[model samples]
Target: MKKLFNNYINTFKGLSIEVWWLSLITFINRAGTMVIPFLTIYLNESLDFTFKEIGWIMPFWGLGSVVGTWLGGKLTDKIGYYKVMFTSLILTGVFFFLLQYVNTIIGFCTGIFLVMLVADTFRPAMFVALSAYSKPENKTRSVTLIRLAINLGFSAGPAIGGIIITSIGYFALFWIDGITCVLAAILLLQVLHPKKAKVLDTVKVENPVSVYKDKAFWVFFIAMFIFGFTFMQYFSTMPLYYKDARFLTEFEIGLLMGFNGFFIFLFEMPLTKWLENNVNSKIRLVTTGLFLIAISFIVLNFTNWIGILAIGILLMTIGEMIAFPFSNSFAIERGKKGNQGEYMAMYAISFSLANIFCHYFGMHMIDKYGFEFTWNAMTAFAFVGVFILLILLQILKREKAQQNL
Candidate 1:
């Protein structure tokens, strides 16, 4: 037990204090993410929204994320990460408070869009800051530590959110979420300095179009979109499945969803460290992760028993633990010195694009074909993503070899 405890401590040994502080900020911010997980329930049960109307409204949140990440990347380059991070956190909190007053579909949709736009700007800025704070050798572990914080908070959020939704109602979710965002911003203000936060010591601006011109990055972008779309079904469609198909309560659904976070928190950091030490190929690790994701969804076709569902969620969480941070690390390593924010932004946009695709198409599938078909389709998508990413990895290898020659 002492040996095990010491190994865990050794995994985090060499990182800077800034990295630790950033991880704390991530934890606090994500701990209050009670709104979105429960938003579907709120729309369906409270507002009497059909799945179709909810689908329409959800894409606006994705549209806002797209805009926010793009603009945030540009701002991170021009003005710097600190200002963008500070403004995003504080304003996002204010918007969450504003959302509590919106009752109509139009009003709710608009509010969601504005809130996400302000909130999601923090994503790319945070990635840029993480890269800035860590050494190259420690990059993957650094990002993993931040993800550890996020999953820890995520594990807490939905579990607590379930209780809040049951006892006090959805309005309380928003108020708590808003307050936490404000608190995270206040904490961030104390630690992050403008001079220290700049990703590049001497700024060399690159045109945003340069990312598009990199053929290998374009392939990577497509793979990210494919994988992201498949994974996002957890948010857009899975909750409805738990409620309608399995006949579970909202609290039960929250527990199942929270299980994903809990599983990752228990295993991800140590697993990532082990993989980094033992694995030689990032491509193999990512492909295996995607395949695991496909299998997780495919298994759902055979059973909806709670135990089976927990197993499936565990597989999917393992896939997420392996794939996501490595993908981010890959993008960051490939990026030019001054273009870190833009590279990370493009990666972030793949997730936003997935949000749009999944909610629009996923809800439609569930409404028409039912949950079984939806899971099968997602499984097929993951398989296709794996194939494409394999080819892209080969292309990247050849490109690197040629450059070396």
Candidate 2:
């Protein structure tokens, strides 16, 4: 454990301004994300909104993420990360401040849409910043560090949000989130100062439409979309599953999620760097995570052992830590030089797509078919995804070997 801790420190021994600022900003944004777990409760209890109403309102988050991911990536390539991050932070804060006015379902949805649109934009700019500052060997470490900050924030933010909500009100949740966002924006503006680099002279001027025609990129798209399907299940369905089982209290749930965050903080950096060293092994881990996710649902359906369920959840978190960063790395590896934004944007689209499909189908499966059948169905999808990713990894390896030869 001590050796592992030292490895984590060594990963960031001499980080630059860009890396430090990006990690700090990400921590703030992720801490703000703590409001999410409580938001449903807030809507149902405090605001007197129904589940169906919240359901209708929630699409705004996915929709806004899609727009934010695309625009942030594009603008960063053209203008730069400084502008992109600053603009996203300011707009996100403004929308967060406006959450207080959302009385009707439509108004709430609109407000959320605006907030997500602004907030999600920061992602690509941050990724571009990481890729820019670090050498290829250490890029995974840098990305892992950013993820670590996010996890650390996630670990702390919810407990804090819960306390504030209990003492003050749900209104306090949004208020605190908004204030943190503004502070993050200000810090980002003040700290991040990248020395401008020369643009590629031979960069192609392909029409935006032409990017869609890249056959290889589309293969990546399909694989990642499968991963996204599983990803959204965590946020949308897991809470309901825990509720149905009657294993959760307000504070316990917060702690479980905080555990999730803590695991990411503990393991992501070392695991990511170790996996990057062995791409083939990393691909295998991705499949393992997916398989475990499916099995977790199967176990959840059959047993009432909360202890066992907790173990299953721990497995699922391991799978996530293995799979997600690799997917990001995979996308960057596949992009042609100078098209990082487009690739990153394309990578992000999978999450938006997953949010849509997972919510619709996952909810239906649980409502109509029962938990066992729904999870079994998701498991089948995971099997197919695993097969597809393996094929892609093989092709990537062969292509790389040929280039080296």
Candidate 3:
């Protein structure tokens, strides 16, 4: 048991202090992500909004993320990750407070859009900073470490948000969320100098290439969109499912969601380390992750058993653990040659685009058809991604062989 504990601890060794600081900042920011996860529930119960209306409002998060990440990417390359990240965090905190007053559908749509625009600008810049802070050899583990912080914060945010919602009301979540974002910005300010090499450096490509022109990345992007669309259902329609089907309270649902983050916190880093050492092909590893997530939804329909909910989350969490780190490594490596911000932004945008479509699609299907059909539709979509990504593995290999020649 001691040896096992030590082995797990070994996974995090040797990373630079700046990388640790970045993870801390991510943890704080992610921990305050209370509003988005519960926004669907709040819209339905408190404001009496229809699922379709809620769907319309939620896509703004994605729309904002798309624009935010793009702007962030450009700003990171031109200015620096430091300024962009710090400003986004502080501005996003202020926006969260403003979002509290937006009760109408249009108000929410605009509010969420504006909030996410500022909030998501941090995503690409954060990753670029991650790439800069980490050594190339330890990059995947470093990515996993950051993800662990994210999941850890994710674990805390919803569980605490649930308590606040149940004890007080949803209004308090905004204060907490906003305060934490500003605090994270302050923490970032404390940790590193503005012009530190890792924080501020942007390499110039001999002749920069357009991220849009990268055919291979576009293929991967499509698959990631499917992955995000399906994965996002956990926070969106899945909560509605728990409320309607399984009859869980807000606190219970938060615990369920928190379980995903907690699971990742405990297991993902060691798991990622093992996979990095053992796996020969990162693409194939991602394909397996995609399948696991697809299968997680099917598990829900497997029985009328309540325990299956836990099982489903477990499967989905495992899939997330497998897919995300290597994909981060792949994107960072690809962006290393030139135009890092664009590549990272494009990568983040795929999920942002998925965010746009997933809420609308999932809620529409659930409202019109049923959860079973909705689950099946998302499953089929992910299976398509699985097949497409396998083809991507072959494409990556061919591209490598040609480059070698």
Better of 2 and 3 by lDDT: 3
Ranking of predictions according to TM-score: 3, 1, 2
Off by over 4 Å in 1: 43-53, 162-172, 195-209, 239-256, 302-310, 370-372
C-alpha lDDT values of all predictions: 0.84, 0.73, 0.88
Model 3 lDDT vs. the true structure?
0.88
What digit string (tens of lDDT, one per residue) describes model 3 on residues 281-329?
A: 8879889999999999988888989999999999999999999998888
Point to the candidate with the largest lDDT.
Answer: 3
Task: Put the candidates in lDDT order, highest first.
Answer: 3, 1, 2
Q: Which is superior by TM-score, 1 or 2?
A: 1
- lDDT of candidate 1 over 189-214, digit per residue (tens): 98877545433323354544467677
Clashes of each: 0, 0, 0
lDDT-wise, the better of 1 and 3 is 3
Model 3 regions lying over 4 Å from their true place: 38-55, 101-107, 162-172, 195-203, 240-256, 302-309
Give per-residue lDDT, candidate 1, residue 93.
90
Worst ten in a row by lDDT for model 3: 193-202
Clashing pairs in 2: none
